[model samples]
Target: MYYVIRYGPAEDNSADLYMDPIPGKKVSFTRGERLGTLPLLTFRKRAGDRGAFLDYLGSSPPCMVVSDRFVEALRSVGVDNVDFYPAQLVDEATGKATPGYQAANVVGLIACVDAAKSVYTLMPGLPEGGAIPKNGIFEFKSMHLDYTKVHGAKIFRLFETTSTIIVHESVRDAIEKAGLRGIRLIPAEGLDAFY
Candidate 1:
């Protein structure tokens, strides 16, 4: 299965999607030539509460999953096992609508699932360590954040050795600024050019 993870803007009302009690800052990035600041999603945390992708991936990985000649190339190479993991926030433990989950972390977890598809995946918001059916191929969206470093590194390295990491052209600068390498950047419209 192929898991394609991309850092793009949120699809709908982020206020409803994210669980951050504190307000998030508007962060700037580019999609093609257009530049804008996307609302970076943060998790809402009370004093003693602590939970994240790390706690989940420590045992298993998050949502398993991605596309585009990206589409052609994938087809040419016979790489059809793809899925997109959505970017959302929820309590990993109860799988309820608690709060305190970063969009980027969510994406990373999705990538984690794609990397290791052997283990089954829980519901998108459910805690990391759980069992479910093994369905391969997924696609998903996510924002950029620092918290995804650990998961990103592991996943990126896996891509380096095993799979291919295809990043969108818009988020390339941001990814570079964040010091992420070994990615193939291509336009959203057509995946003809990759670097």
Candidate 2:
């Protein structure tokens, strides 16, 4: 079984902080591409934001900026498919720097979604060819995967939808056991109304 990763709900009395790649900086964390010699990426807290920085910081386009503990936990579980690049998060309002975070890019792509069993609509002008849509947008209602095509990969982005990240059951167990904050796992079979 696999799961869809998401940010956990915010705690009461805590304001959520959204981080963005500082304007004018180049971002190379493309969907599932393996990066080499990444530029030092810097993120800034959105204006008017003041709050505690969770272990996982949220970003537009869904890049993973995680804490050292989060990195260690994944490493402890022998997950080698992910690459981490050094990153910094600064609050402009107070000039405070939140350290110990890195941009995590999960590598590899597996086009394994079971389109016949899933609910989705292809963008206009595209043919209903096979299980995978060719370079077209798929607005998914619910998603299911073909476990056979996964090839035992612990973590990967779907080729049909690179924006979506899937993790194996063992990976989810490691994260939960480590008590990592700011993360939520939705069963792959239960994905609906999701990005």
Candidate 3:
């Protein structure tokens, strides 16, 4: 089976999830006319630009949930491998402006099911919650809705729920699965195969 994914935004009661187009705007994708109709399709939104609003968060947000403890006060509470369709750099020198900034190095895990893809977004933890600006990070706002309707590889975010430090999900899983565990199902995710 094959999985096609993209990072778009859909308005939610709490948060607006991004992985596809701005929702009801008739848009076309670079992939093809056929694949363009796919929902989870997303175009690459770059983080570095001349004038960026979201960039105000900080100069550089840490990439992984674990290690790289250079981030001032914000720490990694947990990490999840959000399945996302790789973004294509915009030609820039062209293209309009949107509210959100570009994609961060932080790997988001997107899942694929029934030829569709999903982004593993969760509520903002204490650290993430603290960073909430007058404008909040969409990731912090998007709560997984109708999770039962979504399926794909799952990445868990493990945070102390108190500290700002983040721990990688895979490492947490490894620790828990060590010593007294029976049968671990390696994710047969097609997202990994997409690359």
Candidate 4:
């Protein structure tokens, strides 16, 4: 199984675990409609747009426990056994629960990630729609990254508690700083498949 970590919006307690739009304000993507509505640009990375990235995080956070994108990214590449966590959970840093529908601090999110069970898989070539295999162990060079700078720190911390399967030395080294173990480094290229 592939484990992924995702944060919830700091909104009120009544919002869906994924912080889905309040009915009418929902936006849909070409692949499909996510439970939560985010601008298309939110998924695509922009050069040196850290503030924009941060603003997106500030407003939407990431209700990943129920995110279709999170699951689909892995699933599309034949890594279908994916799961997400840290939903409506209390923040360890703060003595209070995450803001239900309001807003939350980044530190609280860090705490939630530290307490979740996320799966990180390192693969070389990502699978395409027609050429996916049913089941087997495959290896390739690391080419892409599953998490962005905004996502890596928050989620990679959980690698400390789980037995993750990594195939790239650089990727392993990157996450090692976050305190990860159970590593099984292999040969691979970019992880573009997860995108």
Cα TM-score of candidate 4: 0.20
TM-score, cand. 1 vs. native: 0.18
TM-score-wise, the better of 2 and 3 is 2
- lDDT by residue (tens digit), candidate 1, 41-152: 3332233335332211111121111112122332343333332222234454455543322222111222233323232323355455443223222222321222233332
> Sorted by lDDT, highest first, which candidate order results?
2, 1, 4, 3
Model 1 gets an lDDT of 0.28
RMSD of each: 17.4, 2.7, 17.7, 17.0
lDDT, candidate 3, 11-110, per-residue tens: 1111112243446755322111232222333332344444322211211111111111212111232333322222322323455433323222322222
Off by over 4 Å in 4: 1-17, 22-169, 180-195
- Of 2 and 4, the candidate ahead on TM-score is 2
Question: lDDT tens digits, residues 87-188, model 4?
Answer: 232323332343222222111111121111222333346543332232211322233233332233322222211211222233334433533222223322
Instruction: Rank candidates by TM-score, best first.
Output: 2, 4, 3, 1
Each candidate structure's TM-score, on Cα atoms with residue i matched to residue i, is 0.18, 0.86, 0.20, 0.20
Candidate with top lDDT is 2
Clashes of each: 20, 0, 23, 21
